[model samples]
Target: MSLTLSLQRSLQQTPARTATIFGTRRRSFREHGDRVARLAAALRSQGLQANDRVGILAHNSDRFLECIMGVWWAGGVLNPVNIRWSVPEIVYSLDDCDTRILIVDKAFAALAPRIGATARHAPLFVYADDGAAPPGMLSFEDLMEQHEPVEDAGRSGNDLACIMYTGGTTGHPKGVMQSHMNLWSAATMRLSETPILRGSTSLHVVPLFHIAGLGRVVMQSIAGECQAVLPGFDAGAVLEIIERERITDTVMVPTMIQAVLNHPDFDQRDLSSWRRLGYGASPSASVMVEQAVQKLPNVELSHAYGLTEACPVISSSGPAHHSEDARKSGLSRSAGHPAFGVLVRIVDAGGREVPRGVVGEITARGPNIMLGYWNKPEETAKALRDGWLFTGDGGYLDADGNLFIVDRIKDMIVSGGENIYSAEVENAIAQHPAVAMCAVIGIPHEKWGEAVHAVVVCKPGAELDEEAVRTHCRERIAGYKCPKTVAFRDALPLSSAGKILKRDLREPFWAHRGSA
Candidate 1:
């Protein structure tokens, strides 16, 4: 019925089964359940009440998983702090949410003093890192040992569950409020579409603070499967874990997948146990998809497309969509069909549905959609209109009802009179053998209202000039779609989630022109 109930079911059904693996440490369902209950008691003792916000700023670890469960068990809301955020960003979220309790891992303990000093309310700090608790903080292990195990609060349905902060690529991060029903429905609906393998072992490489990673965690818990938690993503380390732990399934962004494929250990590692790979967050190049298919012939690939406001998954492209036949039909490039129990439509600016094959804003409606943005009613009103979450993404549905994402609505380039989707241009650039990664943005032009410009990262030892890049794009796309100027970099700026930061790329050019 709820996330807590799901965990209880798993605990009841498989008390002795392995629940989580972090490095050399392993915990059974019973052990994890007991710790979760005690942690809940500890939080309650520290003044956590129904709907109170508790924060966790940590990397992926068993404690991160426990912190998530413990918050709900204590009848509190979770605000998982972004590990990549600076002290100011972290303070803004905590202050905005009025969080009074924060759990920090060793990697982020240094941030406690700064966050406590700046936040609206100085929070009680619980150190979950290795060794003893630093000065003023409470030790997570000590709390578990000292407190009595408490009963589950039995929170379910519309009860507030989490306030996940967005990446803030556009502006200050807004907390997306997720209810118990929203997250439960999202995990269940996704599983209904792509059933998890029984007794499977999943690896957690993505940050638990993000929707994609946290959503996967909820799904894995509901399935009562084994989870292996990684501190963070390391290409070689991931490969080693797959071989050593016999990880059966995992989720990653396309960029992470590409890194794994490009790793030196990729060819040498014994990864036969790995069966399913789910990727999303950004569009995948056809070339990279081909590389993944070639390198991991036995692995089934799936893609999810959604944003934080939608509880993260509105549609999923399954293994069938990645087949050779589907690839040839261009279905592989599509964001796939609307997810189970979710309604999706491409709507024009007036909120009317656009005809198939016409590009428009992608909107979705479902029980899984967030309650609203936390403490921002006006912004929430703008995002959720007439029961539909108007996703600021430009895309179209094909005749076959497959959704093809073009680009973020804000990222589309209007060159002269033509509308150029950056994804299309970037995809074309990716096809070139020498290009490793690329991001296309619109810049102010004297002749054209906006010019198509590209920032490219070439493959190692690969040389590419601006004209050569333009020539390559011209061969595959229209002249207006080709980049008028190309700048090469050893690497492209990437967000923590592995998405290209186009806002960062566009800032310099637009700043001088005094245009967005």
Candidate 2:
């Protein structure tokens, strides 16, 4: 079914129930359904064609949800822009995807001029806000404010739904084309993986541009749950909302998690309503996960493993496993079993099956798999060959069929011809009490072809120096894998999804040095 149907089904069954709570704007299922129907009709009038891309350059807001359903209703696809992207990056995405309609919220209205100028290629532009629209722009409210409810766009199953653009870390970012059914399948199945997100009031703290954020919206809608949105993530602001709204579930990356945990009022806050802490985009540190369980007591920690290409979910580590084996390390280290209705395989370089416990590329195949990259046929073939999505990640399955992500073979650093997995080095570096976060990458070396370089963030009040961190790694990992050079930073670069952008972190240093 189309994700739009999820909302329609919910609204039809529970018209009086709250569909979404947008701060002061309470939208009951009946209210939202009428507006969604109207907006869909209006968009159809504006000439939106089936499978056309409609870009939303907004943060979390009621209009964002409205646009999502409206686009599907109008027989178009939603291309939610990453709110954190620079204006130029936004331009690239809208242009690359050939978006016909651009939706801008008040927060990014000022940027509309530049974005509009660059997006002259688009056919239409609309501004969304409770207030007035910028000059030369159409009003989002007017389009839906008075129109009548209409029929569904009738696009579902393999019909294109959304094109989530990845952060352009390597070269230009490519769009991962997800179909309506592909995402819906991932969403409904995810409830089985993360039950707390079902029939619960969720907060969109993560940027809507990401798979995690968008997937949550569809899943919650299917379960007929209420969603409350925050424009963007702010630690103190999040804590205040959690307490005030009695938020039951939300997904966050490790950085956001750390920010909230370190908030001065964290311990004293009455955040007892939170039911689930869904974390992904990167591995959650064992210490932080353990501490959160002890401190929150009420919240469950669940981990998901996937990429944009997999419609973003392949496996999940939930609270049941957390209670059984995570007090120490065994299950905590695993990224849970393959997700429901999903198949995972670890294969060697030759595409042959590898024995359990031997690290190999983790590949997946299922209904949730993305069709292909928007226009990169070669890369698409490389990724989706043999009916399996070959994720570049390196890991292995255990005797009990639990997967343990040992390292990223694609992200491996080679120094003096010796291979080093960044996760291995980062894990050891995280052990140092003075370190907050770290990223290890291969830097150009005149003789060794490439050398290990460390980019690190130190804990507040800690004075750990570069040499000291090098010594720590040297003592734990292979001596050659230790950083030959270290750069200290207050924070590392992260993608909107909260994964460390190693490509972004490595670009400047290697701009003129090597092909890294």
Candidate 3:
């Protein structure tokens, strides 16, 4: 079913029920529906057509949710830009996907001019905050005020729904094209296995740009539940909202979960309303998992494993896998079994299935798999082979079919729930004049799950320091993607073909620890 159908269903069945809550502002299903319809009309007035790409660069808010539904209702494809990206990176995504309209929240309003100047298509900007619109931009509130509610476009099935830009292995971003069917299938599969009770309140702490966060929004909409949103994740704020909203369910990365557990007010807050806590985007250390189980005995712990290409979920491990007995059997560490309606396999380099218990490249196939990468035919073909999406991850399955992730074949570093491509970081570092060669790897981190570490060889007689390399990288990439530590190396380990052997760089940090 189309995503718009979810809102329609809620409006018909629970029109008077709360639909969104942000700070003191609240909207019922009826009010939300009217606003979404008006937003669609506003979009159409700006020449938005069927399948047009629309971008939103903003923090989590009720308005962001409105933009999502409004875009779809306007028959436009959703292009949720990464909020952490650098200006150039953001421009690349907008240009790459030809997003014609961009919705900017107050936090990102200052960057609109730079983005407009750099982006090839030069998107029309819509200020989505409560304040007055800046010059050359249309006020989001004004648009809704001026336009009349419009009809749904009724697009469904394989129609392109989203073009989510993910970090590429080649020093750029690639747009993952997800169809309406892909998102609906993934959401339904997740809900079928772990159903949401009607009227249950879900707290949205994660950023709306990520697939996990965005997918949960869709799932909540389909379930016709109230969603309490936070502008961003803050340990104290999250706890306060959970108690105030009487939130029943929420999802976060392991890093976020750890932050909440460590918050001084975590125990003082009235958190009895919480029932389910979902964590993923990176593997959880056994110690952390045990702590969560002991500290939140009444709460159900769920783990999901997937990438953007799978519409972000290939498998999930529910509370059963987080039990004490399961932890003793080491099953708690597993990524869990293949999700319902999804088929997963462990394969060798030749694409042949490997024996059980052997680590190999993970592959998945399902109705929820992404349509393909936008504007990259060769890359898309490489990823999707013979109807199977090759997930660049090393994993194994036990005889009982428990999936365990061992390593990241793509050398991707997930820090604070954000994917940082080594190639992208390396390219940024190599541009520094003093750097002759560089390699980036994810080292063990106590707080962020994995820290981006860089190994660099300076030009002969040239000088550089850790901070210098980090500062240089910061100017080019996001602050989080910059190397937390930089080691000056005489040379990076190289293979016979002169390719940098990153395994050697990661060996020292991960020698006694499990792969993150």
Best by TM-score: 1
lDDT of 1 by residue, 1-516 (tens): 589997899888999999999999999999999999999999999888899999999999999999999999999999998988999999999999999999999988988899888888889999997899999999999999999999999999999999999987667899999999999999999999988899899999989998988999899989999999999999999999999999999998877888999998888999999999998977646778888999999999998999888878899899999999988888899889999999998999899999999999999999999999999999999999999999999999999889899988998899888889998999899999998899999999888899999999988889999999999988999887899999999888887777788888899999877666
Q: Which regions of candidate 3 deviate over 4 angstroms?
A: 412-516
Q: TM-score for candidate 3, please give it.
A: 0.82
- Candidate 3 structure quality by residue, lDDT tens digits, 35-89: 9999999999999999999999998999999999999999999999888778998
Error of 2 at 38 (Å): 1.5
Tell me the deviation in Å of residue 489 in model 1: 0.6
Single out the weakest 10-residue window by summed lDDT for candidate 3: 492-501
Candidate 3's displacement at residue 282, Å, is 1.4
Worst 10 residues of 2 by lDDT: 191-200
**Ranking 1 against 3 by TM-score, winner:** 1
| lDDT tens digits by residue: candidate 2, 50-146 | 8888999887888788888888888898898888889888888888888878888888888877877776484377888887777888898887766
lDDT of all predictions: 0.91, 0.82, 0.87
Off-target runs (Cα >4 Å) in candidate 2 are 196-199
TM-scores for every predicted model = 0.99, 0.94, 0.82
User: For model 2, what is the error of residue 177's alpha carbon versus the real structure, in angstroms, after optimal superposition?
Assistant: 1.3
